[model samples]
Target chain A: MQRVNQTLGRIPPWLIYGIAAFPPVWFFWLGLNGGLGVEPIKELEHRLGELALQVLIATLAIRPLREWTHVNLLKLRRSLGVVTFAYVSLHLLVWLVLDVQILSEIWADIVKRPYITVGMAGFILMIPMVVTSNNLSLRKLGPKKWRRLHRLMYPVCVLAGLHFVMLTKGFQFEPLIYLALILVLLAARVPWNLGRATA
Target chain B: MAGRYKSDLKWSDVTPKADWINRRQLMAGSGALALGSTAGPAVASLGAQKTDWGAGLEPNTVEEITTYNNYYEFGTDKGDPAMHAHALTTEPWSIEIDGLVDQPGSYGLEDILKSVTLEERIYRLRCVERWSMVVPWVGFELADLLAMAGVQPSAKYVAFETALRPDEMPGVSYPIIDWPYKEGLRLDEAMHPLTIMATGLYDEPMPNQNGAPIRLVVPWKYGYKSIKSVVRISLVEEQPPTAWNNYSANEYGFYSNVNPDRDHPRWSQKYERRVGGGLFAKQEPTLFMNGYADEVGSLYAGMDLIENH
Candidate 1:
């Protein structure tokens, strides 16, 4: 585990970002090349949304992974969070500009559709975290307050998972699995107090 | 059977068998040619005819028609059917027409086809998911099949069932929906001229992904109302259980007619994006009864649409 930490520490944060950036670029290339099958726009939107959720999940997993396995990937969490925001923004932009072109209908969709309502709420919650992701803002707010503010990720992740579950037409297991994973990660963070005796 | 109802067709309306068969053969042969091979003469000799039903609408490409499908028995994703439905075995198929029908027995697919003439019908298929497509279907009217089976006067509804072959269908493992998807229509609606049992598309046998062998095509309703891989057609008095409605009665109703005025509880029904329309294409306003109100609107004259929906 210590060796794993040493190796992870040696890998530059830019390399992680570089690797993480490939999916969106590849998906766009697939869109341009007619490789996203028949419903390309729908396919692109689904892929972007899924990637955003996956990145957010990865960002949340970093601390738990370090706590459990002692392989600290703390340096990569901020980059992962920013990438999640980028993907979430692109996913929303696609739906707004390409999928639903009518301005009036867009408002109706966000208002009328429960899944989109929750999704929009999650997206709105994420804006502050994205704004304060940089070093300058992180120092401007003290470390403790900054950490507290970023805890909004918990609700964001839960809402994003719910959005996925509601978007499916029928009872699908894939979205439920995502929701389960998020819940499991969140459960791991609970201070069980059973370890208080040892402390 | 011959004297029951007059066909809404003239002698000249039917395409010549030889030419129709040749066109289908040519299409199949061309596909084989693209793979750097030639189809056998047997496959190259089938008949097919192209019909123009949607006058101003162009049919989606054969690739689009075959690849973009929603056969939940195969899987849920749009591409799932194309990737997984190849495992289905449609040959030697038989359909059981039971319930209130006078003739209640399993009928071989070949025997059923011999009793009817095939026609081309280009239709606009609007999915409840708000995606739409124009497809060229080749088949005979469902009413003809029902007439052959001798529908009993007591029957008020016609229920249809899809095939259940878990060995062939992988999606059945997930229970995403109850197995052997079922659908139903009112007796009059089943007898409507627009409702057909499709056997082929693009002048050839339907690709497996697009419900090979036989499928229902109720163009005026949301595409789910037109169930695929139909294996049974039963005449019943009470409203029969439908797959989607059984899953969620609140979301999917029994009479799922396409209506711009009634929104699906979760999504807008006012507009739909044409499936093959380019990425930036504008959404089109959804038409009541999917633009077939002139033909089918009178069928529900006194009933409240929102209540039935």
Candidate 2:
């Protein structure tokens, strides 16, 4: 356990951020070169959205990974959070600018479509957490208050999963699997918090 | 196996040189009758006549048209049918024409093709998903076949059904939808000169992915309205239950026309992305009745489209 943390601690979060940017860049290049298939805009949008959910799930798994497995990656959690936000933002940009290009219809869709409404809500909820993810903001807010505010991720994760589930045409299994995993992760925190409250 | 398909079959594979070089063999309905097993004058070769409907518009490339399709029996994804449709066997196909028709019997594909005059009818297909494509579909008018069947005066609607081969169609294994996909149109819509039963595209026989052997192409309506790999067509007095409408009556209506005013329950129909348009292409405003309102406007002149939609 000690060796795992010691080895991984030496790696800076900025390096992870640099590594994280590679996928979107590669996907953009593929979209440009016809490598992302005929419908590149849709492919790019789905890839970025799935990447965002994956990273966000990793953020939720960090504490459990350390406590259960003793392999700590707490140092990169904030960077991972930022990475998730970046990919989510890129996903929205592709949908707004490339997939659905009409300027007038943008706001209309965000208001009209149920899946878009849930997805936009999730994206908006991520804003404050990303802004407060910095060390300076952490110091200013203090540990207890910062932790409370960051707990907004629980609902954000749910909305993200729900957005994916609702977007699919039929009862697709893949998106439902994601939603189930997110719910399990969110639900796991409840009993521990309740036990602490009773004690 | 289904990540992305580069399409190993080239343009030559699609447009066989031998088929072109040997016109007599082509006319004789040899092994290379890519346009189904129709013989002689009944065979509708590609680019027969350029009418006003298809004057300025060019059909999408065979690659774009074939690769990106929505054959739900093959699978739900656009690329799925392209990847998995090869398993289907299209030879010795037949359709049962029944219901209120004067002549109700099982007609072999060759017999049906031999009866009708094949010609090119270029039309734009607007999918319910808000993507559009113009295809140079080579087929004959649906009215001609109905005329051969001798539609009874009591008939008010025409219902169509697609072949459901569970051994062949991967999608049928799962309960994703009700099997044996069905669709219907008003008697007038089916009888309209614009509606066609397509046999081929780009002068080649229909690919399995694009509903090989036979299919319906109602240009003004949404793509799903034109059922593919049709096996049973019935003339009935009442409107028939369509697959998508049965799935979600609130979302997918019986009409399923490409009307900009009537928005889908999930998305707006005001705009659509042209399928082959480049990655950065802008969304074009959707047309009313897919820009065929001039020809089909009279069909729905008095009816409430919004209510039907």
Candidate 3:
């Protein structure tokens, strides 16, 4: 059994596509099945939004988690980053398709609603992260510059959380918890050496 | 309680009087019977608050209270009530009227409707959640309904309770609150002419999610002050604990009046977005007494609104 497990674990990293696809696939299934309750479509829109934020945060933590644990999770980061983009695209699609239903209305809502403005800003920032996650693009931008570009995730997460807080009219504990979680993740990244030792 | 007017009150200090009228006379004239529910296609044709109804001193605004809702039981979203209340049983309901009243029994919803002569009142509904709706409610004034019950003067406040059915409302499954949501108003507020017991909107039966059968509509207060799907009304001397107050005492005051000046402990209460009117529509400054200063403002004349809030 131990030898069989080792053999299974040694399989090509791309074979792990199943695990990477699970959250979006499961949430999509939940949205379609009406498991999200009476306003399933709206719930889907919100979940896709939160999931986009979550995947971004998780992707941000990959370096810290790998460094702390001494476990190489290098192969999974690109797929996860792309998945974050996918969820964000879905989130924007829901607003465009279900909510605005018209390009003019979408433009109007984006301008009018503050939360929508912040959410759109976060989506726009994710474009570079999505583009730079590829191997060829990483070589083009260089590793140092690429890492700095991805650090935009910190502000993106904060803005995404702010977008959520603004959307909930009344006091909601869930968004606050997300905000707190992001803060701790950010706090963990405080550089003691300021990259002087690395340089 | 009185010296310099609180910075919030712009005009001279006006006492919020009870403005209580003869509940019995109003009830008798309204032409309702206390037995079976009024059966008809009354609500099938949804009308705006300002439609055709018999005339005599009608409220200037015809906002539909039944259509505008903040019943979070359906969901936290504004649109949840219309979508989630489909599973509710609005028909064959009963309200248990107890505590300090001469008559205490489980009265059928239909009987309550028939017993009172329904009037259409147009009033502004401001939600504590920062939204406003102008609803024209069709129902008898609360004073009219209480008159039929022969209320004893000892009843200083009226406590209202919503039906608690965990099976029907999934939101209640997780202790979002202590079930059978409760709210109360001072005897004076309860007896005020502006306080209504609405049964229908848009010329049709009230939708189940909007608190069908019978619900309180206190336009002067925030939307939550208008309790929905009220199953019980208890007249008591003690200050009753209210639902939002219990959930967060600091955030939701017992009075919950629609005063734009007295901010909720967390957020500013200066402005509200009117629903269906898309964003950027000029926000109307919320009135101190929800625009019922002429009718109910005198009742709280000496009370410090910020302290009460």
The best candidate in terms of DockQ: 1
lDDT, candidate 1, B65-157, per-residue tens: 666788888889887787778788889999999999999999999999898887777788999999999887778889999988999999999
The per-model lDDT (C-alpha) reads: 0.83, 0.82, 0.68
C-alpha lDDT of candidate 3 relative to the true structure: 0.68
Task: List DockQ, one per candidate, in order.
Answer: 0.59, 0.53, 0.07
DockQ measured for candidate 3 = 0.07
lDDT of 3 by residue, A8-95 (tens): 4465535545665677677667655434432344556787888887877787676676557655555566777787788889889876
Which candidate number maximizes lDDT? Answer: 1
* Pairs with steric clashes in candidate 2: B34-B205
Across B1-309, the per-residue lDDT of candidate 3 in tens digits comes to: 011111232111211111111221233322212101322333254332332321221221111222244676766654556556766787789988899999988888778766666655555678885667655566777887788787998889999999887777766755556667899999999988668888875445776766877889988898888999999999999999998899878778899888987866544566655554421233456778876776677999899998898
- Worst window of 10 by summed lDDT in candidate 3 chain B: B11-20
lDDT score at residue A199, model 1, on the 0-100 scale: 9
Ranking by TM-score: 1, 2, 3
DockQ order, best first, reads 1, 2, 3
Docking verdict class for candidate 3:
incorrect
True-vs-predicted CA distance for residue B188, candidate 2, Å: 0.9
In candidate 2, residue B180 scores what lDDT?
84
In candidate 1, position B44 carries an lDDT of 44
lDDT of 2 by residue, B1-309 (tens): 011113222333232434434543433332223222222344455543333346456556555676678887878877788777877888999989999999999989899887776766667889998888878677888898898899999999999999999999999886666778999999999988889899887666777888988999999999999999989999999999999898889889999888999988788999988876767867889999998898899999898999988
